[model samples]
Target: MNAHPQPAEDGANAEHATPSGPPPARLLRLPEVINRVGLRRSAIYQRMSEGRFPKSRSLGPKCTVWVEEEIDAWIRGIADRGG
Candidate 1:
């Protein structure tokens, strides 16, 4: 070990440094999306089937996530339309 020890990393943002401009959008798990939009699992699936919600992306054989920006856009649209 070096004589000078580096400070402990801030766990809150240990993944990456703060970004300039708009922060990069990340993939959100189903529960994360539900929590953000306050929708039930079945409702999200129903809306997606009706082509009114963002589609989930397959990450692997059994994993999927939604683009956070897409969900945010959906919410913004609802607000814009006074709904």
Candidate 2:
């Protein structure tokens, strides 16, 4: 009997493994953004109110998301400003 687990026969495991290059760009939900930026929802709203953070766009009747590129740009701006 094999002691080690075998990979999926169809390469599913390999396909799902994390890539080495840059992450794929895609809109993230508010909670995900909050976790990534280490800020509470209230603080996010505060920054949006002050025009310091990118605003979210409606994705559905009750859904919203932030543009991946915009968030990346904002992060770059902060890094450039030494924040």
Candidate 3:
């Protein structure tokens, strides 16, 4: 068997891999957060202004990203409240 298993037809692992549970930390870009949360750019900014969303951390002059854990927590909160 190959040392590195290939992804299945759907491009996902055929079997369960890691059993450690969710990642301890993750970094995600603005576009990724937007897509995952189904939020518009303007809405994201609006939420930031209202302190309802995770703030981006500066990476450089023109780069920033949100903490994946924060975003995940926010999603979980929303789900818990049935929102």
Report lDDT (Cα) of residue 56, candidate 2.
89
- The sequence of per-residue lDDT tens digits that candidate 3 reaches over residues 15-80 is 745545765778898899999899999999899999998898998998889999899899999999
Q: Write the per-residue lDDT of candidate 1 for residues 1-83, one digit (tens) a residue.
A: 76644443654443455655887779999999999999999999999999999999999988989999999999999999999
**Each model's TM-score?**
0.71, 0.65, 0.70
Kindly report which residue stretches of model 1 are placed more than 4 angstroms away from their true locations once superposed.
1-22
Q: Candidate 2 at residue 14, lDDT?
A: 54
Candidate 3 runs further than 4 Å off: 1-24
TM-score, structure 2 vs. true: 0.65
lDDT string for model 2 (1-83, tens) is 96655666765565466667987779999989888777899998899999999998997999999988888788889889998
Q: Could you tell me which 10 consecutive residues in candidate 3 have the lowest summed lDDT? A: 14-23
Each prediction's whole-model lDDT (CA): 0.88, 0.85, 0.87
List pairs with backbone clashes in candidate 3: none
Off by over 4 Å in 2: 1-25
